[model samples]
Target: MSAHRLPGSGPLMVFGGPYSNLEATRALRALATAKGIAPENCICTGDLVAYCARPNDTLAQIREWGCTAIMGNCEESLVAQAIDCGCGFEAGSACDALSIDWYRFASARVTAEEREWVAQLPRQLGFQWNGLDIHVTHGAPSKTNRFLFASSKASSKREELDSTPAHVMLAGHCGIPFGETFDRENGDQGYWLNSGAIGMPANDGTADGWYLLLEPLAERVRASWHRLHYDAHSEQRSMIAEGLDNGYARALTSGLWPSMDVLPAAEREQRGIALQPPALMIEPNH
Candidate 1:
């Protein structure tokens, strides 16, 4: 894991999956600006390009702003000129089909300079945040495209956590906000934090996307999820006009993904329920 040495300063904003939604990307940046956080303190877990219509503009925004981005599977594929989005979706599934469309759309849009930037993104970013070693990656350590949700297996979560030297593993890829504090009898503990995606909703029945903030508390790291309200309607319209897939176009405003091809039954069950992820304070029992 590479290191992105960020100062343990003011409220730190971390987000994922720009997914080519320029509107969402712009709105998220505004939110951080209004919150008084600088670009250097903000980090993106990465998928800088994806389903939406404005992949180029979105990448250009973050590139000019100079935020640290971990390499997402989408970025990796785009840089390598791969065939698919590399999410490891099932063959011939709706997810895979839509991915082919968007991947081609994005691949054609990104310029050489943007591809260079994607090549420069870190696979995993590690840093000491308020006495905790925090590592950020698009997905799990075993695979860049692996999906780990709130309902992921306990053993698998523990295994990934144990393999890492960081006390906190901040992930994206799943496009949903979830936090799990794993406690071990040996007195070691870690947190699996997914900041969620600002480019698209968590399929939880709201037009707003999600992001997470790490507010250091005494002896704990406060994980807070916030809704990012962007111009989804306009973005969706643009996607439609651009001849992109209608599934993500509808997803932009409906907060409902067109396919569950990538999700497990647990996540599929939560569709349209509207998430209200509460702020959690993490503390390891000594």
Candidate 2:
């Protein structure tokens, strides 16, 4: 329920799931700096540390950039000193088992101050661009660990949208980039966008990650998803060197997940298929 409002003039760059991939994190920061986007205008949807090898280094990079970040399930678990990641993966499933390895590695690597900083991060945030209210969260408004996929039913998305006061929801944690708008018969319109993960591939049979940019254009905001190309082979090498044997290490090069246990039926069926997220123009319904 804690909401921080971000003021947007130029494009607001949003990404998620650094996942301890130092290479991707560094690439994203370099891209933002080269484009002259202020650090404050760059928002991260959390999971700053997760499956990759350089958890502490990744956290350092994000902090140095000073990007506005929300707490993801991974951050929540790490901050709370919980037993497992809050991703809601089924017990004894592939995701759960794999998380055990990375979670332990990340938990042991982060500094005490880093843990405190993550513990204090807000669960949700709000901002405005081109007169449209935008909400940023790690998952659905109702649950930090909720999985709101692009393939979810329209009614489900509508329900999540109605639960929040913002006109648009910019979210992450599902690791897939999508922009969907829900319009009601009463003329109310809502937006749900997941810029996808910067630290990890979109399971699209490509090594490139994804990010989103929202640019104001007079009367509307243009929300565009862009692919991020980084040195995945280097990251994977680091992971192997660090003794991390999770499937995600190879996923960096293969652009596929080690397990489909976390994905819904629709998503599971589309595994290894490349994604081409389209640009969306959002205008105020009021």
Candidate 3:
């Protein structure tokens, strides 16, 4: 319930699930610098460490970037020294089985000091842009490990949105970029936006991650999804070197996940098809 207000203006670059991919994290940092987006205006929706090599390096890089970040399920589990990632995958599912090795690898590599830093991260962040109140969380506002995807029911999404006073909820966890506007009974609209993940591709048959750019436009906010290109082969090599050649190692290049245990039917049907989520113009709340 620790929520901090982000102070800034102009465009905000929000991304999620760095997932311990150092190369992808570096590419994002470079992209932010190139766009002249200061660290204060940049927000990460968490999971800074997860399924990949170089967990400690990725943590260090994010700290050095100095962006505003919130606690993800991975951080929460690591701080508590949990035996699993706490990603909410089914107990006997493929995702749960695969998580065992990577979680252990990440837990061992992350230093005690790094865990301390993650423990202090807020559970949520809030900001105002062009008269719109925006709230950011690792997953749904109701649960840190909840998986809300593009195919989620509108009513379910609305319930989560109603739990907060903000006009927009920025979230990550399902590892896909999507946005939708929900109309409340009173006629005001709320937005659900996921910037996607920087550490892993969107299972779109290409080795590229995703991020979101939110820019102020008069009384509205323009939300655009962008692809993050990085050295996927190098990351694969690193994973192999670390003896972490789980299915994720190949996913780095294949742009496909090792398991679809967490994906909905609609999302599973869209696998391997490049995602073209339309840019949304977030209207001010009525």
Candidate 4:
């Protein structure tokens, strides 16, 4: 139930939260092509369709590229024919409101084939490489809608990790990229890697999106986060042209989310400051 053997056995690229920006999605695929990571080796953590202007285009891009994707809360909502996005946003919150617009847009545009494809996507993906077992999920093991942040309880994450029995976990849905290493000596050592969301900015006051590159090593897996440069001006233009919603449209260019609806206090405090994550930074002890 948990193990998959990737045919190529090459480095895999992981990303999340495409949010319907065709341009951003295209840029990501371009990066993969440049790196020679094929569609089978490139995995998306989910929400492939959401807040941007080109939901259909984004879906088409992913489909055309043939990357493997895990169903996010958005896909779950759409697949089950839920009225609103199952993002777990509170009613009347900014996220909830904005979500209504994008969700409706995405729901209306996704074709039958896309919906069927989304419905068929696996909830959890497991594969082995370099003597390590890697598990991929959109959120935590508990629910696809759950938001696991960098500041989320280590105890909570450890408890979730306990469920999978994996040496490393790749998670999405929090929209922030971070790599956390748990000590695990006293049941405290493991790695939680978030590829972040490529569709939207990280609220670091920059337009660059985030993705993770995992390279297998002799002793451990070396995972690093990279900032993706795309044309936010064009992404914003598309949003406005589509007449979806101005709040998210501006967020595209500003690189700061219009609403702090989902961000926790720790993340909210660091808003607007550019985040340049360290490079090739993780030397795992797994």
Candidate 5:
């Protein structure tokens, strides 16, 4: 649970779930590099490999670039040699079945050294920015695979925030970008942010994935969600070529999950609708 401190005054780029899409990974890194966002300032919420082709290549890109990343549930499962993806899908569910195909493919492809590297990854990361204590995780602080969607109740987010001393909690694994602020006694406030995934679409009927940028202004910190555009056709073609022709492969183009099994009812209702993540401006305590 040790934290990785990011030093510098530049905007911090946050993203997650590379999910083994090498094309998207490369594009994202290229954009980050072009923006002069140093590798240290870019944080990945993990799942470097998942339901896509080219697991080895995708992980290689991440390692070569040397960004700050925490261990996601996929890494935990792979490192433990678990039989499944550790996504917490129920038994006999379509997600579970679909996971079996890709998990086996990824597990077989990743090297022993890579598994060791994944095992060594910290489960969470922390740093201080603009007078706020920021913590990052692949999922909720309490659980690696816990799904905290935008529609999750306010009380749930409050309890999650109360579990830690973080002023802001940034996480992934839910595959959607959102920002929420909770009220506390004496006018104190806490924040939860999901940067979404760069490797897959937000089920928003678009081929674009998402990332987040945190820019510290003079009076407040600005958190903005951005859509990452890459060649979804190329990614889909690769998956099809590799026989990964499953839900995730098609999800790249359709922007719809093959199954609603993992999503809450509210999120299920949002399938195929375009996502417009709101920008949040947070003021420092006076």
Candidate 6:
């Protein structure tokens, strides 16, 4: 439960779940550089290694990028030398089964020094941009691996928002991009945003990942979701070469997850359908 405050007013790029996909991670870094977003203004919500072939390369790339990163469940498990990813998947489920293969692959490749670096990452980040207080977390404020999907209950989201004082709370881990605004009991408006994962597709029937952009406008902060197109085929090939031809490897090009075990009914029903999450404008606190 560590937290750190970031200092910057520039446009921020927030993404998550790099998931050890070196190709996708490299694409995102190039995007940030082309957009003039400094490394300090870019934040990663974690899961730097997971169901991909190049765990060590991806971890090194992100570390070299020098962005603000929160420790995801994958990082926590890796650092603790846990046997599983700690994603809280139900026992005997497909997610649990698949995780076994990738987690073992990642754990074996990640070095002691890299785990030490991940060990020091904060669990949360807070910052002020354009008069708006923003909070960042890997999953939920209460639990790092909790899956709070777009279709999750509104009350649940409100509870997480209530735990933080920020006007906007940005999170990742659900692998989908969405935005919801809640009218607080105290009459203020609160926003919950999931930047989605760049390592994997949104299961949107397209071979593209997702990222979030937050920019300050005259009177409001504009939060938008953008698709990240990368060399998915190459990544898939890499996985096959590494003897890691799991569902996630195929998911790179297919844009579909192999299991619905972790998805709620709403998210499960929307599988293979492209996502078009709308942009949200938040008024800065006066």
Per-residue lDDT for 101-122 in model 4, tens only? 8888888888888888788888
- How many steric clashes between backbone atoms does each model show? 0, 0, 0, 4, 0, 0
Give one digit per residue, the lDDT tens place, for model 3 in 1-286.
Answer: 1224364777999899999999999999999999999887888999999999999899888888888899899999999999999999999999999999999999998899999989999988776767888888888888999999988997888888888878899999989999988886567888999999999999888899999999988777899999999999999999999999889999999999999999999999999999878999998765
lDDT of 6: 0.89
Which wins on TM-score, candidate 5 or candidate 6? Answer: 6
Candidate 5 residues 78-170, lDDT tens each?
999999999999999998999999999999999999898778888987777787778888888889999999899977777777777677888
Per-residue accuracy of model 6 over 94-149 as CA lDDT, tens digit each: 99999999999999989999899889998887777888888888889899999999
1-286: candidate 2 lDDT, tens digit per residue:
1124364588889999999999999999999999988788889998988999998889888888888899999999998899888889989998989999899888998899999888878888876667887788898888988888988887777777777778888899999999998885456888888999999899989999999999888888899999999999999999999998568988999999998887889888889899988899998758
Better of 2 and 4 by TM-score: 2
Using TM-score as the measure, name the better of candidate 1 and candidate 4.
Answer: 1
* Candidate 6 error regions (>4 Å): 1-7
- The runs of at least 3 residues in candidate 5 whose Cα sits more than 4 Å from the true structure, single-residue gaps closed, are 1-5
Candidates' C-alpha lDDT: 0.84, 0.88, 0.90, 0.82, 0.88, 0.89
Give residue 235's lDDT in candidate 6 (0 to 100).
94
**Estimated TM-score for each candidate:** 0.95, 0.96, 0.97, 0.93, 0.96, 0.97
Any runs in candidate 1 off by more than 4 Å, and if so which? 1-5, 284-286
Task: Please give the range of 10 consecutive residues that has the lowest summed lDDT in model 2.
Answer: 1-10
Ten-residue region with minimum lDDT total, candidate 1: 1-10
Q: RMSD of each candidate?
A: 2.1, 2.0, 1.8, 2.5, 1.8, 1.8
Model 4 accuracy (lDDT, Cα): 0.82
Of 1 and 5, the candidate ahead on lDDT is 5
Q: What is the lDDT ranking, best to worst?
A: 3, 6, 5, 2, 1, 4
Cα lDDT tens digits for candidate 1, 121-194: 77887777677777777888888998999999866777776677776788999998988877643567767889
